[model samples]
Target: MDLLMKSLKIGVNEKLYIKDPESSTLGKNIVEQSILMIDEMGFDNFTFKKLGVKINSNESSIYRYFENKHKLLLYLATWYWGWVEYRMVFATNGISDPVKKLEKAVEILTQNVEEDSSISHVNEVVLNRLVINEYSKSYLVKEVNQENKDGYFVVYKRLVNRLSEMIAAVDGKYPYPISLASNVMEGALHQYFLKENFPTLTNCNDSITPTEFFTNLIFRTLNQNIHG
Candidate 1:
């Protein structure tokens, strides 16, 4: 898996970037530093100029890689979803049992992210936190309709569809596979956020994880849909 990941390039939408950040050192630095900065300062407070100062480059250089910080956020979100899709494919590969395959997919999607050493420039752990905390900012705007039309969110939608297919594989009769799959993905993020900020509102914590919660919820609903 490590060797495969090392060779793999998680592709983001070309329209999201002025220049691909993975193509050069400075561009990579901008991505790396910006992830950390956004994770630390939150997206509303983050700026390309601040990222440039941290990377010892002019703000204009950052713009060369991205039109604006919103685009950069979209780039990061797309890249992260692409990476998830790759892992989901790898983890479920050759698994014959539909239930087992769906179980593994849930685990991969909801499990706590550890830094993947295969990609040294971007930290998966911090990027995961950024996605959980700030990913909505990338799309929750008046321009979302246009951006969606422009394919800015193709990777994310594809990821959801992949999960939706896995759900359908497990339960052929399940009527709301897409909704369930999307809820698992988005709900895991909300559960994580609640676990951090409003512990009482969520049942997930160190002992009871969001992965376990969602896994249980999925199979239970499917079983009932099948039998009841």
Candidate 2:
């Protein structure tokens, strides 16, 4: 019955970590506390030593899981993308309209995350904030090309592909489904950054949201191409 009752799981790329962070208590602490610390202090100041103290584990123990904080950040970002894709699927499932599914997918990507108790160790809210603020920095490094070769980005690409298919289903001839999907993902995060720092720069009012903003943009762009 336990096998029948198994919970949903999100998997990050194994190549990004020396050990899976979900396998034990100490490993789970490294993930859960790292998310809290990185969210509290920016990534530059976050270290395995500091995380060790916070989690009451040796620095070496944390190192057993990740090579460095950069890899940890990559791991977190990958996990978050998988989580977002999970939420997107749940939000859009059983909805027959492809366009409506795409709209829900946009909202899932853009809206603020709330804590989910099912995955008790990982806090989706802080993880979401971290992704919005720090996700791009995870890949904007000199080693990004090398990391890409290692499949560090598969989960992110999976989300893009999943979303792009929705676009293709809505309008098979839509010339830029991949580009638009990528834009919608990054633009949603960018809007949160803008809204948090420079609210005046965006029209993301309480009534009109970043999700609405991008949803309209995607539909209009695709529809225009369809009619032309």
Candidate 3:
């Protein structure tokens, strides 16, 4: 996503919020600075009290929007996926060929994020970093089944289903469309995670982007099996 890309705005799910953070300055600060802080310090060390002190607000004020840090993380993940879906929709608006559209969707899912001004409070770049590092925690929790039932995972499912449709369009009999779609998303992040901290574990080198790597990977796998 281009840091300078315009008009890519989206809203977080209401189920993820106790009160809409975008409605108030203090709430916005909680969402904005929390992303920055969590991305910097990692999620386990993050707290509303610390975020409150950083944002120059009270702990109680931050709690007014989020039940806990976990819910806030859920909010961030929900927002990120919704925003990604928006990007996919916008990027492939007029595309006809399923292969080309699927490739573009992979690019949207895997590309590096830059700062976006669509929202005044959150930085998409840092939020994407948090998603890369901390996304699994959002759903890899004990309450995940309950949260999934509550529709917290709808945006993510929508993104995968959208791409799976494109995959199915290209090859109606493709049996692994949904699994492949989810892999493209998760695998791209996994590659980025490996490259960022454990460079020796991956060949992500300085030339090819994770986006390009996964796009090529998916197309290659699909091409080999899509027609046969």
* Every candidate's lDDT: 0.91, 0.86, 0.85
RMSD in Å for candidate 3, one decimal? 2.2
Kindly list the per-residue Cα lDDT of model 2 for residues 189-222, writing each as its tens digit.
9998988899999998668788889988999998
Q: State every prediction's TM-score relative to the real structure.
A: 0.97, 0.93, 0.93
For residue 2, what is the lDDT in candidate 1? Answer: 78
In model 3, what is the error at residue 173, expressed in angstroms?
Answer: 2.1
Which structure among the candidates has the greatest lDDT?
1
For model 1 the TM-score comes to: 0.97
Question: For candidate 1, what's the RMSD?
Answer: 1.0
Tens digits of per-residue lDDT, candidate 3, 1-228, equal 445345445667787788998778788788888999999999999988899889887899888898899999999999888888887897898999887888888888888886564567778889999999999999999998999999989999999899888888877776898998888888888989998999988888678788888877777777778555
> Which number leads on TM-score?
1
Worst 10 residues of 3 by lDDT: 1-10
What lDDT, from 0 to 1, does candidate 2 have? 0.86
Cα lDDT tens digits, model 1, 114-222, are 7664586888889999999998898899999999999998887887898899899988999999999989989999999999999999999889999999999999999
